[model samples]
Target: MSDDDLSEKVGYGHPPKKNRFPKGTSGNPKGRPKASKNVANAVELELDSKVTVIENGRKLKLSRGEVIAKTLVTKAMKGDLRAFDAVTKLLPKRFREPLAEANKSEPLDPYEAEVLERYISRRIAKEDSHD
Candidate 1:
């Protein structure tokens, strides 16, 4: 019966009183096997913004942030904290080139192949829900 914003009457507004995520704050929240997905700006990021710096025939196009996040999580899951820390430090800088090259030449790494395949299969299932 009023034109005013519904939340505004309660003293909140269009924007949340407090954002769940601080700007640029990264990491997963509780109670999930998967971490955050579908981040913005990252999808719109152009290839030219960061070129694949391949070397020794290994390559990847993913951002350093993405690589570090995946690597750290995998390592942590395997209970290899030292490896996790090492990968966190290394992948963003040192492995960026090799990963870029490796990605270009190979299907997926042994570790990632299955994960990607399963994700694709699930996505396809959802998309073909009518069938």
Candidate 2:
């Protein structure tokens, strides 16, 4: 069919010429604002900003991202299971493997060991009673 014929047949997918957008005009005249940043870009900028952090009883300046990462690792080290999993997932595979190995070889703190012993004894007693 001729271009004229195709243009004339306007029902569902097409609009009549009078209703169509003008040749030199845009559908969105102002377009996206120049000041707007997408979510990823905004997050990156925020994470890269520097902030004060306290470590080893000293206040130090660090990037916000670094502070967050240190907090996650500290929470993991304090026996927070969810934090441990989150830190493991966030680390590079090579770093995660070494950390896992070190954790396995390292002895638990005295309090942690005592807690584990109590938990095990209680679990055993509960199972024995059930049986």
What tens digits encode model 1's per-residue C-alpha lDDT throughout 18-130?
Answer: 55467776656454676455546556454225546464588867665565556677887797768766765665666677766766874668779989889889978986996
Output the lDDT of residue 70, model 1. 65
Whole-model lDDT values for every prediction: 0.64, 0.88
Q: Which residues of candidate 1, in runs, are more than 4 Å off?
A: 1-71, 74-90, 106-119, 123-131
lDDT of the structure predicted as candidate 2: 0.88
Q: Write the per-residue lDDT of candidate 2 for residues 36-58, one digit (tens) a residue.
A: 67899999999999998788899
* Model 1 TM-score, 2 decimals: 0.20
Q: What TM-score do all the candidates reach, one by one?
A: 0.20, 0.47
Candidate 2: residue 76 lDDT (0-100): 95
TM-score leader: 2
Report lDDT (Cα) of residue 8, candidate 1: 46
Once model 1 is optimally superposed onto the true structure by TM-score, how far is the C-alpha of residue 1 displaced, in angstroms?
Answer: 90
Find the candidate with the highest lDDT and give its number: 2
